[model samples]
Target: MRPALHAEEDVLLVVDPQPTFMALCPDELPVPGAEAVIPVINRILAGPIARAVVTQDWHHPRHLSFASQHPGKRPLETVDLPYGTQVLWPDHGVRATPGAAIHPALDQAKVVMILRKGFRQAIDSYSGFRENDRQTGTGLAEWLRAVGARRLFIAGITRPYCVDWTAEDAAAARFETWVVEDACARLGPDDALDASRARLEAQGIRFTTADTLHGENA
Candidate 1:
């Protein structure tokens, strides 16, 4: 049987469910089945969870993470930054753009906090907990701790990157973390998703489907 969530101790974390990501076309940086996961996430939000937070990738137009900022570089290519390997991406999540807004289908009213990340023009933030530079934090950990969140229930777009990084960091911070498998989509190759799952599992992060969370198969 699957474990049940303790409403007082667990918090729901929705990672980067913005229109910039959810509405991506096949030719763009589309996460396979990204749109289909929204309903699942909404259902989870409607559950008895006591607290919820949302992460937004609010990047600047000319952020270093954008391939366009670097001449001769293309999206999906990698460059070594002072921090580490940085993956170049098509310009996205520019502040004040319609795509940067949360998806219309999501119930934003349920969220208690909205953490905007990657606002720095020179740095990229993939994890809700920290910037890609690894030295800078978004203060999510401190907030979760203050609210007595002992476990984290995470769901959102592009599992291999954002979701994966957030889960890993949450686990490292000693919070029991679980990724709602059906509530996330993968942006990269299939192997990337598999590898992320393996890495998270090895780090002691749990996985459950939306059905299991809803007690449908429990």
Candidate 2:
């Protein structure tokens, strides 16, 4: 049987549903099929879930994660950073740009808070809870705790990175975390997504489809 999400005890987390991350737009880094997930996310938001939070990949024009900043290196190349293996990407999610804005299809009015991350010029932020440095937290966990959110339901663009990292961190923070699989798009290879699923499963994070939730809650 699927668990029911109580409004007061559960919070819906939308991770980086921005134009910069969607293939539907000609943004610097668009994830394939990212546009398709917006409707799925909206369906979840319109369901029984009440409170919600959204994360934005708000980066600086000269952010360290951009490949253009490093001469001779193109986007999608892997470079070792002080943190670990970092995938160099095109400059994206620059603050004040249209690409940084949330997808127009998303119901932003329903979100209680908008958490802007990756604004640090020197670091990259994948997890809504923390920077890639793994120590610099965005205080998402604290906010969730303060709001009395005991469980977290996550949905968004790019499954292998942001969504995966957020679920891992949320579980580590002692919240019952569940990822709505169909509500997310993968930016990496299938193997990467498979590995991420394994990692999340090991941490006890649950996975479900939007249809399952809608059927149970209906």
C-alpha RMSD by candidate, in order: 2.1, 1.4
Deviation (Å) of 119 in candidate 2:
0.6
CA deviation > 4 Å runs, candidate 2: none
Q: Model 1 residue 186 lDDT?
A: 77
Top candidate on lDDT is 2
Model 1, position 49, has a per-residue lDDT of 68
Per TM-score, the best of the predicted structures is 2
Alpha carbon lDDT of each predicted model: 0.85, 0.88
| Per-model TM against the reference | 0.94, 0.96
- What lDDT is reached at residue 43 by model 1? 85
Candidate 1 local lDDT, 52-140, one digit each (tens): 79999899889899999889999989988889999999888888787888888887666888999999999899999989988799999
Worst 10 residues of 2 by lDDT: 209-218
- For model 2 the local lDDT of residue 55 reads 95
TM-score of model 2 vs. true structure? 0.96
